[model samples]
Target: MNLETHEPVAENLGVLEIAALLRELTAALLDIADFDEALTRLVTVAQRTVPGVTWCGFTALRAGEPAGVAASDPRLAELDDLGHGAESPAMSAVHRREMVLSTDLAAEERWPDWTARACALGVRSVVAAPVDIDDHVIGALNLYADAPDALTARRQLTAMLLAEHAGLLLAGVRGREQRTALTNEIDETLLQEGVIGQAIGVIMTQRGCPAPEALQVLRSAALALSIPLREVAERLVVTVSRSRGA
Candidate 1:
């Protein structure tokens, strides 16, 4: 929230440069449709736009299992190895719903195995921020650098903002998808009702049965055939039309 407070990192661009980069990144985010694609695009953008970010990745809970879903570089595949049981910085950020920064991975002791592995991969520092939307932590964004103390306070703020932006964009995309699905369901229901009503009318005209009796006939045929009433109604309507043509 306090974008103006921290001192700029030496490895990073000036304030105006970062602003322009953020604008371009937002444009890229808007252009993406799939959530997985968006996450991959975001990590790639972060590695390019954020200073000293050698690699980037995101960890999210998918189908109740925690896993790394995206990474900017192939080397960052180490992220995927951090299974749900791994106590890595990304897990910490998502669990705490806050930022987790480590300036010297070699000396880090919180997660010895993770730190050692990252150091072996030439990653000396990292910053992880939780992607939170609607007061819920959905995932974590992680940025890595090969040098010590690379992710300064200013860059951390920028990373946090980027994570928040990603969360908001994801929420918007999901909302639109849900609305579209609901609309499709409603259209299908109305179409089925109309067809079934027409079939009932046909039965009444041909058999001289009341509406209730005609509906019972349709239901009975459906149950005998182990199918839906709508299916029986649809078949009746099609058959009567074909008979008239004959």
Candidate 2:
């Protein structure tokens, strides 16, 4: 195998070789926990496994615009930014929810401006495959090469398979992140409620009032002070602690 190009020295990859490549990809990404880190790892894997790929990047749609989310190299990130518009292969793949291939940027007529800019940046061939998560077209995986026609049929297939795997992994990462955030939010809410309950009890004892009347007084104080109920409750609790200590 040619390490630089990641291609077989004498022939295309056999079935076993392809299986090995897939196993490598799965092993590399299975342990990632963060969404951004997963995307970074994905691009790194693309550069190592895709034949003739000199650079790799991931682009995500934000507010209906393409944004470079990750890259195997810093230069690839800059290259991804150039494709933010409709003329870029990454944008096209995301919009069409399919793969877009440019065999030679110099001879490409479909996106003249993008081709010109890519060529100037030493990108001669490109493959962009849409990444889908839960039936939604979320972004694109881009493979770039410095030699014309380098992203051949086999390379395109590899890119597509990688994109599919990335989508599944990213979806799991996102779900876990969301669950963690929700758990934290719930804990915070419960803590705040406990503080408010303590404040209400303090008010009841100090003013010789019922629980409902104490709560009403606290609400009135919060309204007059133009502060949140939680803030007022926290302040009251802290003041009582200080007074008891003194």
Candidate 3:
């Protein structure tokens, strides 16, 4: 994050205005229940709020590979395909961990082929900002415009701020997902423990075997069946219950 660009976003969007927009975006992002949904909503918000942005999308990388994309319009996803064989402006932003601005795509010297493709789509200007989380660039937010020089300095600064916020929100969503998965794993372990304990008790009562010995029997059965210990315990308990009823 550059301190020079870190000042107020835009004079047109005063402190109060930017603050209100941030609050709204934050609330909406927090309400998202899944990571994929959050990514989609992040670009949607950028397209709606940023001036002269005709389209918005994001390209995420993992282990230096292009992983996935989320765009406001499905057709805009073609931008990510450009990232595969050649270095488009968006991937360059992600790799360099900085913003890449092409005020006029027609004269983009570095990526002439990509510029020609984008021109065919009626895109004349583009601005991409690295979605940095904890100083690591995970993705880039790509904004496109139909007219040249549409993303002015002030607008670019505003887009950068929004991209930063999206990164934070994405990190938070990932954290929540990991925590939930861990909790579910713990719950499953507890349920398996209870089932195995009940099966051990049944074995002890029926065969007068010690608890450890009964547990060993259950483990042997699991190994023989090539199944989980919990499945073996469940089958044993069910069989015992049925025999008692009969």
Candidate 1 clash pair list: none
Off by over 4 Å in 2: 1-13, 82-84, 135-137, 193-246
TM-score of 3: 0.71
Worst 10 residues of 2 by lDDT: 1-10
Q: What's model 1's overall lDDT?
A: 0.76
TM-score of each prediction:
0.66, 0.68, 0.71
Candidate 1 segments whose C-alpha is farther than 4 A from its true place: 1-14, 62-64, 80-84, 134-137, 180-246
Q: What root-mean-square deviation over C-alphas does model 2 reach?
A: 10.7
Across 1-246, the per-residue lDDT of candidate 3 in tens digits comes to: 442244454453445645665776798789565777877888888888777889998887766766668888887678755454557877778767788889998888977777777898888999888886433328888999999988876778777778888889888877777787886676455444788989988888878997767777877889999999899888988998898899
For candidate 2, the per-residue lDDT at 50 reads 68
lDDT per residue as tens, model 1, 98-124 = 888888887899888788778878889
Root-mean-square deviation per candidate: 10.2, 10.7, 9.4
Model 1 scores worst on lDDT over the 10 consecutive residues at: 1-10
Give lDDT tens digits, candidate 2, residues 1-246.
Answer: 112245553464456656776777777767665677777887887788766899998887645655337888886575567444466888778777788888888889987777877788889989888887543327888899999988776677677767887788777766776786886675455444788889988998899997667777888999999999889999999999999999
- Cα distance off (Å), candidate 1, residue 156: 1.4
